[model samples]
Target: MRICLVASNRFAIREPFAGGLESMTATLARGLAERGHEVTLFAGPGSQVHPEVRLSPLAVVEVSAAAMADRFAPGPEWVADHHAYLALMLSLARTGAEQFDVVHNNSLHHLPVSMAPALAVPVLTTLHTPPLPLLESALALSPDASRFVAVSEWTAAAWRHVVASDVVLNGLDLAAWSPGPGGGPAVWSGRLVAEKAPHLAIDACRAAGVPLVLAGPVQDVDYVEREVVPRLGGEVTYAGHLTGAALARLLQEASVAVVTPAWDEPYGLVAAEAMACGTPVAAFARGGLAQVVSPDSGVLVPPGDVAALAAAVVRAARLDRRAVRAHAEATCGADAMVEGYLARYAELGQRVDAA
Candidate 1:
C-alpha cells in the first residue's frame, strides 16, 4: 500500500522532543517501508529526509506578530493555536491528497478534520493524547471520519463517549532497548510534567532507600517549577535531556525503571521502554500501564499511592532481571509491533477499497 503519514509540526522529527506520538509515527512509517509498503512522511521544519520514506516539509511562516499578541494580550489562548492549525491544513490541502492510498494523520488538530471528506483517500487518524477538549475537538470535527486508531484501550475508553475508534497499542524496538548487565539506582524518563508525575518517582525512590536518576525534557515549565524542582534533592539526580548513546547508557545503568503518572495516561511509554530494556518497571496501575505491565516484568500499584508505589519498587528490586528482559522481547518487541500494524493496515485498506 502507498501511504502518506502526517506528523506533528511542533518540532523536527529527529529532535528528541515530544514523546510517543512522534516516535510511533516514525516507527510505523519505517516499519511499513521495511515491509515493502510505499511510504511518504510529511514532517516539520526540523525533520530530515530519510531514504526509506519520502519527506515533505510543511511550509513555514513567520508568526512574530501573533507571538507578540499571545505573549502580551492573552485574551483567548486558543486563538493562536486554531490559527496555526488552519494554516497547516490549508497548506496540505493546496497540494491535494490523491497521491496515496491512505493519509495517516498524526496531528489530532480539529482543522484537519475539515479536509477529511474532501481528501481523495481515507484519513486514518491515530489518537495519541486525551483530554476533554481534544476528545471534543476530534468528535465535533471528524464525526464521520473512518479508520480511527487509538494507541491504548484506556485512550479509546476515554473517547468512547465521543467516537467509536479501534484500539492498537503502541509498539517499540526491543532490539534497541535490550537489557544491560548490572547498574545502580532507579531511572525515571519521559516528560518532566505534572501529568507524568516525575516528582513522585523521586519521592518513591527516596522512600525505598534508592537513588533516583531523572531524565527527559521539561515539557511543562510551570508544572516542573511548582511540582518537580522543589522536590529535587540529594536522593534525586537530574540527568536532563538524553539521546542516542546517552539515553542507552542511562537505561543500562539503572537498577529499575519508574513511571508515576498523576493523570490517567493513555499509554505509558516510560514503563514500556524500561520493560524493553529488560528492567523491571514499578509503576502506578492506571490507564495503559495495566495493559503493558505484566507480573513477570514488573509490579503495579494504585495510581498516586506513594507507599504502594514505593513498596512495589522494593519488590521489583528482588525479581529476576532476566525474566523482565524476556517478557519485553516476547510481548513488546518491534517485530511484533510492526506485524500488528501491517495486519491492521491490510484490513483497513481492504475495507476502504470496498467502500
Candidate 2:
C-alpha cells in the first residue's frame, strides 16, 4: 500500500526530535517502509530522507506585504502552518486517489481534519494533543470526515465530548532503548517548558537526596531562566537537549526517571522511553504516564506532590531493572504500534468497500 503521512510543519520529523509527535511520525514512516509499504512523508523542512520512504516538504508560502500589513492578519508562524496544510489538502483532493491507498493525518493542525472530506482518499487522524477550539470546530463541522485514533485512553476520554475515538498507545523502539545498568542520579527529560515543570523534578530529587539530570530542548526560555536556572547546581544539572545514543544512555544509567507535567500530557513518550531502557520511573500520576508506567516498571504519586514524588523516586529506583525492561517489552514495542495502524487501515479499507 502507498501511504501518505502528514506531520507538523513546526519542526522537521527528525532527531533530536522537537517532541514526541516528530519522533512518532518518523517511527511510523520507517515502520511502514520496513514492512514493504510505499510511504510518503509530508513533513517540515530538514526531515531526514530514508531510502524506502519519499520526503515531501511542507511548502512554505510567502505572505505578501499587504497581507502582513493588515491589523487582523495572523502571526507569521500560524500563516505558514495554515497555508502548508491547506496546500497539501488541496493537492490530495486533486490527485491523491491515483497515488495513495490511505492518508494518515498525524499532524496537530485542524486544516487536515477540516479539509479531509474533500480528498478522494481516506484520511485517518491521530489525536496527539488535548481538544482545541479549532479542532473541535472541525470535528463538529464534519463528524465523520476522518477516522480518529487517540494516543491514550485519557486523551480519548478528553475528546469524547467532541468525538469518539479509538485508543492506540504510543510505542518505542525497545532495541534502540536497550536495557542498562542503573546506578546514577534521577533524570528528567522532555520539552523544558512551564507545562513540563522540570523544576519540580529538581525539587523532588533534592528532597529524595538524589542527584538529577534534566535533558531536552528548552522551549520556553523565560520559564527555564526563572525556574530551572536558579535550581541548577552540584546536585542538579541540565544536559542540553540530548539525542540518539546520548539521550538513551542517559536514561539507561539513571537511578530513576522523574516526570512532572503540570498539564495533562496526551501521552508520556519520555516515560515509555525510560522504561524501555530498563530505567524505573517516578512520575506524577497524570494523563497517559499513569497508563505507561506500570507497577513493576515505576511509581506514580498524586499530581503536583513534590514530596510524594520524592518518596516514589526512592521506591521506584529499587525496583528490579529487569522487571522494568520486561514491562516495556510487553507493552511498548514498536512492532505493536505498526500493527495497530495496519488494523485501523484495514478497517478503513473495509468501510470504503462497503460504501
Could you tell me which 10 consecutive residues in candidate 1 have the lowest summed lDDT? 72-81
Candidate achieving the largest lDDT = 2
C-alpha RMSD in Å of predicted model 1 compared with the true structure: 3.0
Task: Give the per-residue Cα lDDT of candidate 1 at 355.
Answer: 78
Judged by lDDT against the true structure, how good is candidate 2? 0.91
Scored by CA lDDT, what does every candidate get? Answer: 0.75, 0.91
TM-score of each: 0.89, 0.98
Model 2: CA > 4 A from native: none
TM-score of 2: 0.98
The sequence of per-residue lDDT tens digits that candidate 1 reaches over residues 1-355 is 8887887666566646467677777777778888788887876666753468888655544456756576555434445446655665565565544566677787766656656766656677777777457547656776886567777888888778878778777777676677876367899999888888898898898899988989898889998899888888887888888763466567766788988988888888777778777778899988878888889988999989998889998888667888888877766666666676666667767877787
Q: Clash pairs of candidate 2?
A: none
Clashing pairs counted in every model:
0, 0
